[model samples]
Target: MLLNLKNIYKNYGKEPLIVPVLKDISLEVIQGDYVAIMGPSGSGKTTLMNIIGCLDRASTGTYLFEDEDISEMNDDALSDLRLNKIGFVFQNFNLLSSETAQENVALPLIYAGIHKEERNHRADVALSKVGLQDRTTFKPSQLSGGQKQRVAIARALINHPRILLADEPTGALDQASGKQVMELFKALNDEGVTIIMITHDASVASHAKKILHIIDGEIIENKQGGAA
Candidate 1:
């Protein structure tokens, strides 16, 4: 298993006001699997994604990545896992406004201590993969909504992460641009990049091979389908 969760639980606060988000949740994702998490707001989908990406720990329960227990790892270890193993594409293209596409994509490698030349090389290759090779010098402010999200995708891919975690990746784009982004995701998945996308749109969720429906903090359905 590339990812596994066992009886994961999350709660906020203490005593009478404690709000439990996930209740005895368990899940597994294998290599090359394209999974989509579907749910309405407040259904713990984001919390589940955070735990899977190692951005947050489960309040209780075990999380294993490639059979190693990550729930007990230190902050630095989790940070390393996040930086080297997982890639995140957010709904809001989280690019630095002042930085060019290449610079923003190079940020992760910089943190990894890669040399500048190699960093730029990797960033350039990732940009090329996203079909944005010509826009390497453009800042986020100068790009269209679709282009900015593609830049974010390039930044996420620069590290060659094992898993791609996208949160509402097309939410900010118009229908046409959103379809373009989804096409990119499909191409990436065909090349064996495991993806776990979170979205409320059924049309968007159709892009994955597996659809997991969450309701009231629990997984209520698991559907298998082709890409949209």
Candidate 2:
């Protein structure tokens, strides 16, 4: 299994007035699986994604990612795991406003100690894969919303991560741009990238091969082969 989460729970605040976000969440994901998580606002889906992406730990329960226990990993270890094993795409693009698309996509490779030439080459290849070859030198200010998201996607792919976690990737885009991004995600999944996306829109969730509907911190529905 690529991911195995069992009886996970997340709580906040002190004992006097605590809030539980996730409740006994158990999930399993295999390699190359395209999964979507859908829920209303404040339904704890974000919290669950954080744990799966190694950004946060569960308050209780065991999380075994690729059969390795991640619950006990320290902050540095978690950072390494996120940097080397997982790729994240966010709704807001998250690009440095001053950096060119090429530079932004190559940033992760820089942290990995890759040579500048190789980093630039790989970044270019990734951007080309996302069909943004002509926008390599364009800064975020110069690109459209779809182009910025494409740049973010290219950056996520630079490390060749085992799994991709996209948080509302289409949320900040217009209808046409959102459709373009979803198609890109499907194409990436078809090429064997394990993807987990979180969205509130049913149409967006329908793009996944499987859907997990979350409500009140619990998984209310799990369906495969997309929606009927």
Candidate 3:
């Protein structure tokens, strides 16, 4: 299994506003699984994604990644895990405004201590994979919403992560642009990248092979072979 969450729980605080976000949540995701998580607002979908992505720790229970328990790992360890193993695509294009697309895509490789020439080469290759090789010199402001998202996707792919976690990846694009992004995701999944996306739109979720419906901090239903 690439991921395993067992009886996970998350609480905000200790008082009246102490809301329980996830209660006894258990899930397993193996390699090559394209999974989508769907829920209404405030239904704990984001919380679960945070936990699964190693961005937040569960208040209780175990989180195992590749069969190794990561629940007790320190901040540095978690950072390393995120750097070397996971890639993230956000709802908002989180690309640096001042950086060129190629530079932004090379940032993670830089942090990994790769040589400058090698870093640029890898970033260029990743951009080519996402069909953004020609836009490498453009900044975020120079690109359309879909193009910006493609840049972000190239950035995510630079490190060759085992899994890609996308949160509302198509939220900022128009219908056509959103379709393009979804198609890119489908192509990536077909090439064996494990993808986990979070979206409220059923149409967006339909791109995945599996859907997990979350509500009231629990998984209400799991459907295989696409969205219901």
- Candidate number achieving the greatest TM-score relative to the actual structure: 2
| TM-scores for every predicted model | 0.97, 0.97, 0.96
lDDT of each: 0.91, 0.92, 0.90
lDDT comparing candidate 1 with the true structure:
0.91
Which stretches of model 2 miss by more than 4 angstroms? none
Model 3, TM vs. native: 0.96
Give the per-residue lDDT digits (tens) of candidate 2, residues 119-193. Answer: 999999999999999999999999999999999999998999999999999999999999999999989998999
- Candidate 2 clash pair list: none
Q: Poorest 10 consecutive residues of model 3 by lDDT? A: 219-228
- Model 3 Cα lDDT, one tens digit per residue, 31-92: 99999999889989889989899999999999999988996688999999999999999999
Clashes within 3 Å, all models in order: 0, 0, 0
Per-residue error (Å), model 1, residue 92: 0.6
- 1 or 2: which has the higher TM-score? 2
Error of 2 at 141 (Å): 0.6
What is the full ranking by lDDT, best candidate first?
A: 2, 1, 3
Q: Pick out the ten consecutive residues of candidate 2 with the lowest summed lDDT.
A: 219-228
